[model samples]
Target: MCHMTACSLLSYIAIAWMKMVPMQTIRSRVQFFKISALSLVFCVSVVFGNISLRFLPVSFNQAVGATTPFFTAVFAYLMTLEREAWLTCLTLVPVVAGVIIASGGEPSFNLFGFIMCISATAARALKTVLQGILLSSEGEKLNSMNLLLYMAPMAVVFLRPATLIMEENVVGITLALARDDIKIIWYLLFNSALAYFVNLTNFLVTKHTSALTLQVLGNAKGAVAVVVSILIFRNPVSVTGMLGYTLTVFGVILYSEAKKRSK
Candidate 1:
């Protein structure tokens, strides 16, 4: 939960900063359409992703989360229609292996859960690549906050109905929104905020870093999230799981080093 809390806090700060920053005019309908469509896709991804979480174990979820890089790689390649080096392809091996290992053994192989996770991963990956492309093409015109301002309103539209039906009793929810529940509220708020930041950061990072490096570092998020989840939830930490997490982190470090050397 602390991991979630920290992520949430960072997200909130990002969102707040986005609000404070002035945005350029939505000059073209095409840009507006792209933002709306992409934001909606992201909203759907989050909804499905959240639902999948209920059926999947935390370890499984984290492992699936770690697959984002692979998905991102695939999406980026398809979008760009560019072939990457052999080392880039090889890097995915450790990432996949680490995820399988860290998932507390093999996943249960639930079709629905697996599908949801896969869809969520693909959606997120596509969104990242699209956002990167947008940022690259329109860097001066579209600031980070502009992306948030555009995305958030669309997210609210997508999330509001779901919140009403799935998370009904807003009054009760509001009542429980106390200091003790600060963590939960913070997490939700920050998660929403971070959703935007992650999109923005992906653009910046991909611009500055290699795709493989961005992906590898992104995979580490799962390892960090898992470790944090284990500590906070007092989960049983198995030897295999520890080994897997270690490998995942190591792989990320290697990928980062490779990027540095290449630069």
Candidate 2:
């Protein structure tokens, strides 16, 4: 996360240097409280997401994560008071049910890991809803790049203290590990570049579309994650798990269709 946020900040600075956008404009006068809140949400989503991987199989993790739209609707109403159509709301039923079934059926499920994944999912939803709320006003509105330009550093600030407290001697341990394997540095550099793009595109998507729409698109990505996890990692998945994921994805498709028809 440290590397990811730093890369995002530096990359935006490089964009400013290239005269693509003025540094001054990138440094928009967003409310301090809003940015801080956003950073905290971003940190929770990412930190808990990584933690979930340690205890759950990648396939099962994506299955649980696929229910983002369900949480998004809850947060949307709570934050923005923007209610979906009754039919659209109804479509979320299977989305919720599938995750419950999947969690029960997952052979590698850890109670703590499942909680972290659910929290991460909720944080992502909250972030999406909060992004829409905080950045919507004409006076405070920022384009995707400028918004990220502010968010990345704030995330770094919010995460550092927690990281130090939770992972004692992390700096020394990482240095020792790096000494044993210089390739670790290269891998970090590579992933840092990719993380910037992932974050950039997320903001871009949310900016162009509704927050729920962003969650809908995010839910669709789970199929690919599941496929790659099976192919590369050869993760064991039970029949119940596959059926549950199928039901979840099917429900998401129905929700998308309901959304389009409503529009």
Local distance difference test values of all predictions, in order = 0.66, 0.82
**TM-score: which candidate is best?**
2
**For candidate 1, lDDT tens digit of each residue in 49-131?**
98887776565667677777777778888887645565655666676677677665543445688678778877887777766
Give candidate 1's error at residue 75 in angstroms: 0.8
Where does candidate 1 clash, by residue pair? Answer: 8-190, 11-194
Ten-residue segment with the worst summed lDDT in candidate 2? 21-30
The clash tally of candidate 2 reads 0
Q: What's model 2's lDDT at 89? A: 88
* Clash count, one per candidate: 2, 0
Candidate 1 local accuracy as lDDT? 0.66
Per-residue CA lDDT of candidate 2, range 87-148, in tens?
99888899888888888788888999999999999998999988877557576677666677
